[model samples]
Target chain A: MELTLGPLAYHWPADIRRDFYARIADEAPVGTVYLGEVICSKRAPFHEPDLPATIERLERGGKRVVLSSLAEVMLKREREATAGLMAAEDHEVEVNNAAGLMDRGRRPHRIGPFLNAYNEATIAWMAGQGATHVCLPAELPGHSAAVAARAARALGVGVEVQVFGRAPLAVSARCYHARAHGRHKDNCQFVCEDDPDGMPLLTLDGKPLLRVNGIQTQSESYVELVEALPELAAAGVSHARLLPQAVDMVAVARVFADHLGGMCDATEARARLAGICAGVSFSNGFFHGVAGYRHIARLGTAH
Target chain B: MTGAEDFSAAGELVCPAGTPAALRTAVEAGADTVYCGLRNATNARNFPGLNFTPEELQASVAFAHARGAKVLLAVNTYPPAGQLALWHEAAAIGMRAGVDAFIVADMGVARHIAETWPRARLHLSVQAAASSPEAIRYYCTHFGVRRVVLPRILTIPEIRAIRREIPCEIETFVFGNHGLMVEGRCSLTNWLTGQSTNLDGVCSPAAEVTFERADDGTMRSCLSGFTIDRFAAGETAGYPTICKGRYAAPHRPEGYYAFEEPVSLNLGRLLPELMAAGVHAFKIEGRQRSKSYVRQVVGAFRRAVDSIRSGHDPDLADLVALTEGQKETQGAFQTKKWR
Candidate 1:
């Protein structure tokens, strides 16, 4: 199984992003890295100037690089950006929205998780449209993922599943991060930068329910599939994705790599991951077909 | 601006009907088109005690057709893996029922409908979340989609801009739930309740919802055991959908609507503006509401459309009581500042 890094969903400073990618290029045990702004387009300009250098560095480090498009493409500028990305000649583009798919018609591309590839028939249709790889949506249960992965594999398409990081629950036309601060999406002054990981939102009863990052809403707990990696691989999934969070992602990659490589057991890997993402909780219930916020312990590996 | 005569001729009033009764009510109340779904996961409003059976859909289609109204079948939800048979069956039923169009979201469903009938009309469901001209054109080019329902995330200017580019017809939501999140892309309810609008065709499924009276006498609405919102005495409590729920954040310890307030989207005043923007159809969203809601809302929009077509200001009914949370907003239609 191959370890892939998903695009960053935060608004970290340009230099911080550069430094973070530099480390991933050098030390991260990931086979492929997705680079681009998948959330708010307002933050794309800050880090876009350094894209060429980062892509080259990751490529030189022996990692395949793919550019991801925005999850929600409403504005003309966003459409233009999606078109530009779709027209790239070098790096493979991952189409997250329909605009990208339309622009990249019949061209080789990867399907991002943002585009719902929920069923076998959808995967077949995407493969017919020249999609070479597909990362299934985060909400799929184990049975459904297995079915989708098998179908994609039968079509000579690579299947990927997110194995780490907060699951993106929703994307909106309005920026809740800005709205929470009493500002509009237009004049928010880039306030989402304050929460690199994402601003936490709790329920009325004081339970951490979700995280708001610009227009995207994410789960409060990081989705850790250390125990489920073998199950996923057995079900024909070739790639496991790890989304970039505010934590030490390189170390997070190592934990997943070690678990996938059979160098450490699931319990030890979970412990190390807990230490890395110290304060945050972990969940795997989405795979178990229950509420995504709950962590379902494996039957034999209950700790 | 387009002439009043041209606006009236081109614009269509699309209304919702959860059941055969609602379908009749909407058509008789002056809906040019009525959209509904089968009682299954093939449509977004897969609530129990709602939607139509095959026989009911056939009767309703005939009834609407007799009144010079078109019937559209909503096979909108994404079919789960190995579950295409269910949606295909629903489509076959709709076809046999002689529905005028099939409103769809999934590519597989769209491809099936396009390939099966070859000449069947397809309206891109809002759940597809196609906001731009390119995306809409993609559907029109690929599946020969006749019309596209724009997501409730675009402003009037954006809609006008899109109208200048796309080849197919444009449909915009004129009233109903202010869906803050992009349709088909949202899984907040699934994360909390394990049933989603995209996959299961339900949001915060009624089976998972519960209501309780707190010690202070305030009503607490919960979804899947999580407290979504609390309403004071005599305040109308809204459905326990995750997005419109009140939440507590560090910035505001006092609970606030973290995603969106529980307000309905009422574009009654924007009829003339949207008509001027080249919108081919105005859609009302409430498949899970009552038959009376269908009559009142559809009748009100019918009069509004007629009044606007005659070059006069519309005298719309006050639908505040019928709206969610007893309040309404023009939503993202008027301005992006609604964010």
Candidate 2:
């Protein structure tokens, strides 16, 4: 299968974002790159002006680029931006909400995880709406993922799964990062940039629970699915999208690419990935139909 | 949109009914519209020992209709892949029962209802999580939704802004368990337990819920072996959802309500403001509650809506005692707070 770099879900300095994508375009083996802000819309202006240049750079590298719409479109400006994204004809658009779907009309678009397409009928309905690819929700078990992937294959739609990064667990209208910093959503200075990955949330027993990123809450542990790559491909998944993180993504991509090419052992690639993302935990419970924090290495073999 | 003349009285008193008795109690207590779900995963409140059979729903609909009240069927959960037929069957059963409208959340379900049962009236369930006018307008234009339930995240002015832009009717929660998480968008419970609130319509399924007492004389509520919230001795315990639980974060040694404390939402005081803001219905959100709760809360809202129309002050003092922990807040309606 192909490895696609998912949209950047966190806020970073514009220069860092620009440099990161530049390095990916130059060195990373990722076939496709999703560029745009899928989180808070307020973070758009910081990086939007530089997007055309970044897209140009990536396209110049022979990488396919897809523009992503916001996950939750509540404001008028966010809606207009979504409509504008749909109107753009140069690149493919990934719709994350119904507003985007409404604006897309007859255009062949990609459906993001935010818009739930759980069952076969949902996928068929989305295909009828001219959706060409769909990223299943992050909480699907291996069994469900296989079922959905097979269904997508039957409908001639490519299925994508989140193979890396902290899986998003929730999205809220209120900004938890701003709330934690004692500021309202409207007037608060963007405080989510403090944690380039995401701010960690712990349980009362001092156990890590989730990461807070503005209005989105994600699993505390990054979901590493390198071992499940074979199962995903066997299930008819066409793409495994890796969300960007504050790490050497070029090395991360190379490791994933090496695994796909059968040039590196799983142990060595995993060890290399571990060295890149130090002090971070990994979990694959959602893939096993168990608690999200639990790392179940084996799939249906478990229970 | 239906004209104000269709609802010549005060704001509609929309009530919740988990059981048949609760449905009858709510109707007898003067609820203008009573909403309930079938005994399946189609509805958001898919609790055990709750909801109705098809026959029970038909009888309840006739009872409510005889009393000049409308019964709405809530089929508001996302269907998992290959399980779409279940939701379609749910809508068909609701239509057979002669319910006035269907409250739906999933886009596929909405499309199915709009296409297969074009004559059926549709209301957007809060589980759809459409808080903006653009989102609501999309549903109205695509699915012919007659009303949209506002998610519990919008302020009064935001609701008013949406009311001005959309042609659909508005409904907002006036009482019950406050979901701090955005409706329809949360999967924390699904991450912990196999069931999903958005798809299976069950959150922290009872099968995965456990309460244990610590030696320190505190009650700890756990969902799927993970602690959701702990209560001190003699402290009342709320339902263990991952969002409203206490937790510890870095730099903060003491465990606190990292998301939100367990406080119920009480918008009773803002009945007049809500009516003036163009909310067509005031919804009471407790399908898992008791028949007495259904009777008392619906009765209070009925009187409050009447009082507001007659130019009298609403009596909402008694609602405080009925709330979880007997504490309430005008959540998100007054203004957005950091907590």
Candidate 3:
């Protein structure tokens, strides 16, 4: 199965963002890349110059790039952006919500992790709307993903999973940055530039809790499916999306790529991933239909 | 929009005010009734720099009353653990200030109001997300909710279908940032940060955000710390929220909005259609907006309703500049093929 690097949910500097994609374009073994500003309309202009360049570089280097739509509600500026993305000539688009489906252009489009695809009917419907691939929401269970995958395969729609990185659990309208700094959303001084990785929160007992990303919230632990890969491949998932995190991401991508390429066994892959990703926990809770933070059968846990 | 007006108007209009200016704006703008909560978490819009101090609310109530407008105190916040007293006190003081009713959402708050003042009128808040007619009827029977503000996810057909089975006046968001997708129970905000619009009555707490000019001439905006959106130098930027930002997917080599883009719901054109669908009252969003906005938009909608009643086409104004980054959308109201 192909490995897709999901959008960088963190706002890295233009150079850092460029270099990140550049590295992926040249060195990383991933097959696909999805990129764009999916949170606030203000950030859309930042990546304009670099996005086309990176897309061209990635395409020249043999990586397929899919443009994405926002995952939450829309405002006018966002609508224009959506229209522009839908109107783009060459690449396919990943629709995060159903809003883009109303005016989706004739492209081999896919569905993003949002749109609340809770059941098989929604998946089947996306296929009818001309979705070629669909990534299930992070909160969906593995069994549900499998069920949706079977349906997708039947309808000729490719199914993907977020096998690594923190789970994107929810999106919101309120800007946490402005709220945190005692500013209204309109006057937010662009304070979110301080943290490249999302702002981290800890429980009262000092446990790593969650990371805030503008209006979107994500999990503290990364999710990995090294052991579950065989099951997922057998269940008809076409690809796996690896979200680039703040640390060891290149190495992390290599580990997954190695596993996918049959260069490493499941046990070695898990071990190498653990060595590179120090101390941060991994969860399949969303796939297992349990609490999102809980890791079932953790690495190094006595069986 | 579908069907004729089925439910007769009952109870009153319960509006919102983020500031005292908005309170006056709502009052003078022809609000039949005005609703607000204390500066604490007694109401849902508990973001900073909003709501009323006890004295201001009391004064605002007097002002509204002298102008023949009724004040409905919204003590609708869910009570935090072991903190029922804060909600209780907000309700008690609202009653003392001669509020016409208590717009309550939580069952605990409803119980508190009932036990404290048996004669008080209580309307159900939209935080309850009671969609089915059976569900709303259950609230009316148990909590004595005089009215219900229906969630915006419903179409006119759905609202008319609901009118056939409910026993309360229906209020729908007419001109405002209608949250079409998010349900009341979502924690996408809380999961990223420690605060939430539901638990804390706040979303995307400002203290956690930062934005910077990336070296590549792209501007990146983030909430908490996650990149919500990135804009090139020429593109317009709205407030940075995660769901509205563009992200990359494989299908398109270019980046796009992977969740949703930030769009405001401006259903100005659909007023005639929604009115025919048994809607008793229309609600405008953005208690967090400016007084000038409050005066213009609310007054505009008020006039729209009057114009509709007089069987004239409503005067249309391009109020886009009043919006965040001046962006607005018809949302899900106009599209029949909406997924």
Best by lDDT: 1
Q: Is the docking of candidate 3 incorrect, acceptable, medium or high quality?
A: incorrect
lDDT of each residue in B26-144, candidate 2, tens digit only: 99999999999999989999999999999999999999989988888999988876677889999999988889899988878888988887778899999888877767887898788
Alpha-carbon deviation at B321 in model 1, angstroms = 8.7
Clashing pairs in 2: A118-B81, A119-B80, A119-B81, A120-B81, A120-B82
- Which candidate, 1 or 3, has the higher TM-score? 1
Residue-level lDDT of model 2, residues A100-187, one tens digit each, is 8888886999999998877776787889889999999998787788988999999999999998899899998778888777676887
Among these predicted structures, which one has the highest TM-score? 1
Enumerate the candidates' DockQ scores in order.
0.81, 0.57, 0.04
Question: How many clashes does the backbone of model 2 have?
Answer: 5
Cα lDDT tens digits, model 3, A80-99, are: 67767877768888876434
Q: With candidate 2 superimposed using the best TM-score fit, by how many Å does residue B233's alpha carbon deviate from the native?
A: 3.8
lDDT of 3 by residue, B124-160 (tens): 7776555556457656765667678776555677777
Candidate 1 positional error at A152, Å: 0.8
Error of 1 at A35 (Å): 0.3
